[model samples]
Target: MLPYHDAALPVADRVTDLLGRMTPAEKAGLLCHAPVAVAPDGGLVDEPRTLLPTAPTTHAVRDLHLRCLTLMAPVAAGPLARWHNEVQALAARSMLGIPVLVSSDPRHSANENPLTSVPSGGCSRWPEPLGFGALGDADLVRDFARVIRAEYTAVGIRMALHPMADLASEPRWCRTAGTFGADPDVVGALAGAYVAGLQGDDLGPDAVASMVKHWPGAGPQAGGEDAHFASGKDQVYPAGRFDLHLSRFRPSLHAGVAAVMPYYGRPVGVDGLAGVGFAFDPKVVAGLLRRDEGYDGLVCTDFGVLTDATLADGTVWPARAWGVEHLDRVDRAALLLDAGVDQFGGEWCPEVVTDLVAAGRVAQGRVDESVRRVLTLLFRLGLFENPYVDEGNAVATVGRADFVAAGEAAQRRSMVLLANDGVLPLAEGIRLYVEGVDRATAERYTTVVDHPEDADVALVRLDAPYEPRQRLPEAFFHQGRLDLPDDRREHLCALAATVPTVVDLFLDRPAVIPELAGHAAALLADFGAADEAVLDVVFGRARPEGRLPFELPRSMAAVEAHPEDLPGGTRDPVFPLGHSVEALDWRPRTSEPQKG
Candidate 1:
């Protein structure tokens, strides 16, 4: 039989055939993802460049049909169109003529930064996903996804690495606001809707693909934390306990997500396994995802998270524990390939694999398998048929009025009214005292006041500080639980006494509201959002329809209760799961007027 890479057949057919023809070294090259840049001198620059890089030359590596290109966000339609044109041209140069896939992280939101691209040119800044979850409207979620899809597709971003399916069980999880909710059904349903909207009826080149992520549930870190640090990196899905978290992901997979990006956290019992990261784990990626669940989609790793950088002494360490330790780049490649990963997202390490082949450490056959999978996905995405778009369309398509409306709508829905003393639905034209409100958001309500003493009603928005207490490191904050020193609590108590405050906590995890509960006239909680929409809920312009998605622990000790001991398990939280109070009609005190 002819090998998979042989040129005499259709591109897809050739990819399959060529897989058999190539050595493992060649196959591994396809799994490596890198930013595509034009070499200043028209040469292939393997390393990323600081300059405005153009697409790679089509003729330079015609034989090596690259699978995907990772692009930064806020990219305009013109540049995107040029990228598509270049990729298509490259595909045409090859005998198989396979197109290249383009991907990016959430770029449609205000939080776009190094991890994501944001064009100085206008793009609608939607409130984060947490606000959408608070709204409890699946349709709104779909609308949000649709707008994002239109914006991404207009700019040639074919895949959206979003709708983070992880449960918001841990409030301190940095990415909590990106998820739908803590309930399996809620997260699952919303995630499915998001995927459907993104892919739509037409899974064509113009439609964006969804990469729902942090598989097998990333909410439960060792201490209710992020999985990046070695101390907090292990994932514990105790036997029979996997279902609690896995429920959200199963629905997303069923919803036909185009890709799954396993987190960098090491799964329990993954030690000594050939592949360190769950991204390269057979049990998680191959056995569970492919076999048991029956998902045959592409699997990509989180960016800059797989392998450690070279040290001053030239030693390469694992970037995360889930990443293989003590392995050279080639060995890591071999492990990932054997474990069934389709591609490496974020960073080009193809040279590492190529070097391994040259040193005879890796078999050529293994590389071919990965390459075939990568090519298959790109070809399926229809990148070859439609590669480029007009630059003008990029800015024009982003942040459209409809998109902004959807974003605002999502923000309104996500606000949850935790408690109301019937002082809400403020009468129009009342002076409102606001703290921590964005200047623009406050302009709509009342004159910004330096002190709450002169204001009619005091409103405050406080986030769990990202900065750590003097004694505690910042990592403690990332973990949902914080054991504040008594002195710190005392200091907070002093601050609370100054105002009859309406406190709003962005609950990433359930914290003790009672600590400062006495000082506030009313307390409100939300997963995440800007202050304007939050104020809308405060004044009852929009009803607080949100219910508590997870249990709130009254105390850290209550949180420590066994998961079985609690409603779900011994893990009893201070606030039981599903605790929510409705906003009541409040007539302002006779002396104090209601605020708008």
Candidate 2:
């Protein structure tokens, strides 16, 4: 067997042997972390069928010589396993037969938001990461990570594009649901536990490598806008909390995470740092992360940083090169490499790297340096010996009964009771009026009523308010205003006037809810939970044990006035961070309105 192919050789030795044998094109391909799609019938899709910037699978694997890929398509476990094997077979037939390292965004959550996580397709559905933050249980976070690792490895996904160590410091940030709350210490603890569970005590064949993301925290976007768009590119730290943002990443680094993904925002007020995207700023990537922090692992850019991606539907997702948008693709590629980035995510251009080396803009040694890290990860995961997974095993392990039960339990427990006026743990056999809840599930707990006036109590389900952006992908991110529309607020108030109401608001991101808090008899916040899970808590079958991960602003005025860079900055939060009420025993009370 070849030195690189031998399973017994040291990882460094195998990486060195593989590096010496690779051509310039192969080495370039290793740096392209492009997206690929999966067909419905368990086949590899070679077309750009989805809105994500995906290349033809066959061309990306064989011609471009790409080895690193990200999966964005939602598919069942069996089909995903089949598609994975098919891709592995194609890679095995390539020139040097290097194994493909497949990675995926968080897919084990109940979120259907495309910008953050895909829907849980045959995977065990748990509450979003913020839910784990609400619980603040490191052991629970570790157990959740263990389930994620098992399911991912079963389906041949070696790299987890998650465990976002970013803080939810900025309440209006669309990506808050993906982070562990606003507290730096809590986020650090959960992130460390998550990394340890995924990578274990040591990274090996049994482990799924964690890529802790958006280094230095992607929160604190100027005006609470995301950095994904040019209009929202600035990441301001007016409070001088850049160091606090960096603090969240220290535990993940200590846990020995395999990779780091930097944010796309340009630094503002960061001392001695360029006003460029974190991926293109050498001071941030090389000096701050690599030099001062002493992180030696692989660093990958956030998706579509080098080139603009045009979707199949004629929508353009502009390149998020931010402060360096004036540069050409080659120059952009060189800057990222010089900034110490090892891979270009959502970018399918291998030619950029090859051309950079050919034009002498970047050294061959730099290319080898990144290629060595990439190969080391693949070798450490034992992908060379076995990149393929058993479809039967994948079908058996993914969404298994125990795993699903644990996820459901987490969803039920992660709900935060914001306010209770002795109107909760709702008594049995009462006529209930409901909205945004499954009728069948509500029937099991209480008698269903069509109107609030005709019911003893009303259970109303609502989502945290967000003003929608008119654009395609931007609209997918829940952004802008956090207050409920006037009409909806009035409607809820009217409902409460008719009967006592129990409101369950999905708190994916913190909202301005003082008006609603005033009207609703009781209020509970959830990160992500199913109708059944919500009902379980409402009816005392399960407990609402979650505490607020971040503060809820009293008004949109408060949200706008609060400093984005500082956590818990609102002047008078309606419900401050760590706010939650204990469940009272279920008792029947007179159906009378209680002033909130």
Candidate 3:
């Protein structure tokens, strides 16, 4: 006997009534998630046998009501329609008829990838958030959000875990591409517009719920790196820098974001809270977010991260920090619940939660609290109103021509001019040499050259190292002890020696900018969409108006002086923050060909 029936009632009260009737096993079921098809059969993680156990095997609607299910993998365009239909059918078979809440990581772009998760069926692959900030156009930000919302809603995805509001304070952070910029005001305004575009005029039915993430902030990690592993878990905020980071979140919260996600890093010294990550700390989650901030929305933990874990990639690791490995999964769940985490993102430990209740290690009341919050979020998202999709519109709505147009516009706006030595806006018909341009993107520009010597104006593109999968070819992820590897450095140096190179480094994180002080003609760096828009700026089709969003450290040593000690940590960037050189007028020194 669940509590309330009318969907129109307040979400908290409705959830409260429903939580009172659930059995311990049913409450535990809400905490577990099964992985579905990550991609069509033949791609990475291709074993169907590996995936079968994760598929939704049975619906426990009647006996013990199941609340929600997060999809494991992304479904293909052709099969997505069928998949949604099947998922809806599963819900119908359940006792409570609760529709599954399908969600996903950022799928609107190709940059962040293992490509193991589901691909968005319909949506233009917009430039990453850093690119959006470069545009500095609020309307485009709104449009990008709307396009993502349309694609997600069309495909039966009710919630979007996106519009990462973290600022790019630490350039070495691997996830810098996902954030807006270094300034909190800029990130806040753009992020809010993105939220508005996703949710629409009405907060309830018209818009998809936006989950603003890594609450408080995850930007200031010890080293500009992810906090997931032990090496980069400490977060230090001196003299209340938290207010600067909180600037972005405040707007999203006011705009009625549906949920918040805390990061994995532990914080040091704030209001008697000694050292604790927000995910496992009641002071951070309940005290700050829920109590002080007045955010009534659901709070979920980051995926596959727990305070303690007995398993490591399916193998056991020795007992680690915080007594995590020693504590069982149930105890971990209890800690999360008490700390005010409403839902476990991509966690697969339902049996442990069940065991805890049976053993009386965890109270039934606490389980009910988390379950209520999860259900409340689902209901607020309007999942129950109509959970099935039309299927026919899935492909048509996603990444359509209009959406691509919007993405292109955003890409153009984000281009910032780093340097121009009167050689830019090359005279019409001058041969242009470009390295690192993809075939499709190159076609938009002049012909790409095999060697820089053959062309009149040489352009090259570079990016910070990002290994898409957890297991990358050893050559890419690192070299010796520092971030950039030897082979990549050698390759770039070879190209710089060949011509008066115009280098465009995709400045997501500050990498070791090779000593091209005398080697290259001009250097231009940008945070987003470096490949696509660099061509436009090169030929004077578009003006380079962007400025460095954050400080570019000279070397890894300089980065170490800051809170998040990054590789290439030196304070002297080849070009400092806000450094941009305008295109200069040029005259050929001599028309005569010189000996190569």
Candidate 4:
């Protein structure tokens, strides 16, 4: 057997052996990470996707010699395992027989953000990452990582594109809910613990190599905007403490994270580097991340940064090439290769790289370097020896009883009671009027009432208000003012007047709801909570112990006035960060959100 296929050999030796045997085109394909369709019956998707072209999974495997794919959809454990087995079988027939390395965004969340994770796909649902951040405990983060790793490995997912190490420094930023809070020290500690739990002591068959993402941190945007759109292209550090963004990433290196992803946002004049996206800037990617930081791991570009991203409604978001958009496809490929990027995410443009090599714009040896790194990841994962998983075991291992129970407990712990007017921990058999909750579930605690006027207490669930966008892709990204409209706020206030209302709001965004909060008898906040978990806290079955991960702004004006680089910089937020009330032995920390 070749050194690459020999399980007894060192990972470096295995990668070198396989890379030496591969052609330039194969190497190019190896460096391109593309997307594919996974059908229910373990076959290629017949229908085309709106953004990506329709290519048979076998074509990518056999013709392109592609070995890595980003899984876009989430399915049942049985079907997902079977589909992975089928895809590996397809690759088995190709020349050199390289197994596929499948990766996915965070799929463990109960409320899935399309850009970040999958929705309701049968994976054990935990609260959004903010839940763990709210707890402010690295030990809990380590525990969550253990469960996430087990679920991913069970379904044959060898790589995770998550643990978004970017700090939620800017509360108004649309991506705040996905992050581990705004505190750099807390973020770094949790990031370290998260990596330790996911990868264990070393890379192996049982380990799921975590690709810690958005390196150098994509959080401190110019106006607290998202990097996904052209409107939010500039990632500026106005305070001149650019190194502050990297505090969370320091621990990732210490933990031996297998891979790193550079964000799509352009860093303007950061560390004397050019104003371009990190993937396109050699000074940042090769000089800063590689030489200065000593990160020798694979550096994957953020998805769709190399090519245009399309929405369902024919809106085209130009390639996030940032400073290099003027250059054509081949030139873009040359620049990326020069920047030491190991892979072009969300793209299968191997021909462009092959042309660059053929035209003497790039050297074949440079291509080999990336090919070696890619192969090493596969070999260390032990995919070459056994690529397929037992479908039966895969079905059983995912979302096991213990995993579900632990996730529920975490969700319950993530609930933060913002305010309570002495109406919580209700005694049994009270009249309860509920909205956004199942009536049958309410019967377990109280007598269900049809009207707020007839009830002793009313329970309502509210979403953190966001300005609805009309455009296709922009609509998915929750941006603009965080304030609730006057009419809706009035309705909530009126409801509170009719009866003492306990409002449990889903807080994906830091909503500006001061008026409604004042009117609400008891205002509770959830990062992501199930009906049962919220009820458990309300009825005294479980205590509300979670602290605010990010501050609730007082208004849009306060959010606009706040500096994007500074956490708790806003002028007098509604409820400050780390503000939470307990059911018993409650203590109120009054004042603006501040660092402890």
Candidate 5:
């Protein structure tokens, strides 16, 4: 058997042999973690023009010898499985016959932000990670992880770019739904369980490698804005508790996470780390995660660290260089390489890396170092042995009845009761007026009414408060102010006055709505639960075990005044963190308006 192909050899030995055989261009391709465009016909395209465009999967696999692939879009289970197998076949045809390592952002969720998390799309739909945090049971998280792992493996996806270990410290942060919660301890415990369940207690062929992400944590961003756009790139620790964010990563490391992704935010006011993007900062990547934290695994950037991007619709997205914008692109790439980052996401320019090495700016030895890490991941997963998955089995297993049921149960358990005025378990036979809920769904429990004045109870479904901004793709993120609009607030208050109103809020963010909370006969918070799941919790068929993952600020002013680095920092919160009411008829303990 070939030295690189020997199953008995140590991973280091196999990686060393393989790296020696690969050319500079091949090594450079390994560093560029670009998106692979899967055509509608299930065939691979080289470079297709689409809304979200990238080099073709076939080109990345066969020509560039790029083995890692991030799933760009969602498709049916059978077709996706078939497409995955085809891409692996392309990689198998490459010189060394390396198998492709398919990765994706979290897909087993209710909301599918096209740029970040895609909808389940023939996958089991579970509550968001924040919902898991609300449940506050690590065992449940592990169970959910196992379900996700099974579905992912069935579809030939081996790497999950998620189970984000970042805490929801900044409630208004656009990426809040991806995180566990505001508390570091809960986030750490659940994150560990997530890593263990996805990767398993033992790692091998059946395991789905969890890339525990946003290292040094992304909890303390300035103004609750995201780093995805220029308006939200600066991460400041005003309270000087930057170490608090790093605490969640400790459990992930102990569970043997396959990789760690540094966030795009530039850390400012931190003691040791430079203000450049975390990927370009050595003190954070090498000094903190590698040296202090003692991790020697793959460190990937959070997409597009090397260059700016232009959407297929002709919209321009500036590079997230953060503090390093002054440096040349080649110099910036060199900086990231020096910082101990192993992969560059969202960019597929192998020539830039090759030219950097040939010009003596980046050492060839450094390229080998990253290549060794990348190769080791492939070998450990036994991809070289067999990478293709059965499309028939995939159709049978993915989103099977049992898997979808488990997800539904999880969604029910993730609802939190915030306020009540003795109108619960939704009294059967009541006249109900529901605005956002479909009339057919409401009719199952009560007589549907046409107007609020004609009904005994009014059901109002609302989205989490946000200062709306629309930019293709960016529009989906839901960033900015966390206050309900005045018109909406007046409408909610008016509905309450006309009838006993039951408000169901989609609490993706900690909404600041004190008026409606006081006026409503009952209030419940949901994190991506379906209509069926929500009704199940309301009808006493299922119990709601979820608690508030983060505090709801009493007012938008309080949200602005509170420090982003500190959870529950509002001067007065409407609903405190960890607050939950068990299934029963509930009423406010006090009628007077008082801080939570």
Candidate 6:
């Protein structure tokens, strides 16, 4: 047996042996981490399936020698396990027999954004990350992560592209639902627990390597815009709180996170730093993350930074090269390598690395340095010994009854009680008028009425306000104004006048809701709970233990006036951070507020 194949040896020794034996082409492939789509039957898609360009899976594995890949399709556990084994079998036929390292974005949440998270797809569903912040319990967050690790590893996924360490300081940022909260202290603790739960003290076959993302924080985008589009490229520090943003990452780094992902936003007006994307900024990646912070783990860039392409509908999807868009592809790739990024996400260009080394633009030593880090992680995961997963085991382990029950319990616990006027616990047997809630679910609790005027109480479910952009993919991100629409606001107030109304607001982002606060008899905020879970909290079957993770501003004007980089800066919040009222029947255990 080869030295690298012997599991008894030290991981470092195995990595060193594998790195020395790999050819330049193989090393180049290690730098490219491309996306792969799964067919309906769980086979690899040979044809183009999505807007993002991807080579056929077989060709990417055999011809390009690519070993790292991300899943683009949301498939069930059994199918995904079958596909994983197929990929590993093909990879074993390669000259060096390197096992593929599969990774995925958060797939267990109810928020199904195509760019960020996938649908549950038969996996145990849970609330958004904001809910975890609301609960403010590190132990619960770690327990949730343990379930994630188990399900992911069952399907042969070794890397988790999650636990976004970026704080949700800016309210209008589209990705706020993915973060823990605005407070660095709270987010840091939860992120550390998430990393520890996934990787434990060491990463092995049973553990999934956690990749804490958007290094230096992507939350403070100027004007509350996201970094995904050109108009939102600038990450401004108006409060001069750049260092404060970095505080959220300290605990994750301290926990020995397996990977770090630099964001697409470029820092504006920072001292002694270039105004460029974090992945292309040597000062940020090499100096701040590597040298200053003393992190030596894998550094991967966020998706599609090296090249631009067109969508199937002919929309120009610009490369997120940001400040360096003027530079050509080769120069951009070279600059990113020099910036200390070890892997290129959403990129399929292994030739760029090979050609750069061949032309002497990038030294062989530099290539070897990155190759070593990638191989080290692969070895630590024990992929060489056992890369395939049992389909039956995956089917049984994923979405197990216990796991589903735990997730449902968390969803109920994460609902924050914002207001109560002696009208909650829903008074046993009151006639109900429901909107946006399923009739069957409401009927189980009490009588369901057709109109608010005929009912004793009204129960309405409302989504937090967002203005949709007029672009295809950009519109997918919930951005723009946070205030409720005039029509919806007026309609709600009119209904409340007819009967006492109980509102359940799904807070993907903090909403400006002074009118709702004044009109609704009771208000509860949920991150991503099911209809049953919401009812469980409303009917007092389960008590809401969540605190507000972010401030709910009284007006959009207040949100605009607050510094994007600073937390707790809203002038007149309807509900401040950590604010939550108890149910009418809830007995107080202590005078002091609960903290995470």
Highest lDDT scorer? 6
TM per candidate comes to 0.81, 0.98, 0.84, 0.95, 0.96, 0.97
lDDT (tens digit, per residue) of candidate 1 on 464-491: 4343423212222334453345675675
The whole-model C-alpha lDDT of candidate 2 against the native structure comes to: 0.89
Q: How accurate is candidate 6 locally (lDDT)?
A: 0.90
lDDT of 3 by residue, 56-134 (tens): 3343323334444455555654456556666667666765666777666677654534212234444566666777666
- In every candidate, how many clashes are there? 51, 0, 23, 0, 1, 0
Residue-level lDDT for 66 in candidate 1: 52
> Which residue pairs overlap in candidate 6's backbone?
none
Alpha-carbon shift of residue 433 in model 1 (angstroms): 3.0
How many backbone clashes can be found in candidate 3? 23
Per-residue lDDT value at 287 in model 1: 79
Stretches of model 5 off by over 4 angstroms after superposition: 584-596
TM-score of 4: 0.95
Q: Give one digit per residue, the lDDT tens place, for model 5 in 149-199.
A: 888998889999988889787878988888888977899999999999999
- Candidates, ranked, TM-score: 2, 6, 5, 4, 3, 1
Say which prediction, candidate 2 or candidate 4, comes out ahead on TM-score. Answer: 2
RMSD to truth, every model: 5.6, 2.3, 4.7, 4.8, 4.0, 4.3
lDDT of 4 by residue, 1-596 (tens): 76777888888888888887888878888888887767765556645653434245777778888888878776788888988888899888877888999988888885555667766357777888888888888888888899888888888888888888888877667887778887677778888888888998998888888889788888888777788877788887766757888767989878999999999888875668788888888887898789999988898988877677655557786777777778876788788889989898878778888888899989898888888888888888889999999889877878888888988898988889899888786556677899999999988766888988888788998887877678766677677778878898888889988888999988886889888778988988888888988888887787777898888888788887776777676788888888888667432222221111
Q: After best superposition, candidate 5 residue 403: deviation in angstroms?
A: 0.9
Q: Rank the candidates by lDDT, best first.
A: 6, 2, 5, 4, 3, 1
Candidate 6 C-alpha error for residue 525, in Å: 0.2
Per-residue error at 378 for model 6, in Å? 0.8
Model 6, C-alpha of 62: deviation from truth (Å): 1.2
> How do the residues 1-596 of candidate 2 rate in per-residue lDDT, one tens digit apiece?
89999888888888999899999999999999988888877798886778766878899999999999888878888999999999999999987899999998999886776666766668899999999999999999999999999999999989998989987888899899899999889999999999999999989998999999898789989998999888889998888899899889999999999999999999887789899999998988998999988998999999989888787678888899999889988999999999999999888899999998998889999999999999999999989889999999999999999999999999999999999898788877788999889888899877787877778889989988999888788878888899999999899999998998999999889999888789889999998899989988887788888999999988788888877889987989999999998775633333333222
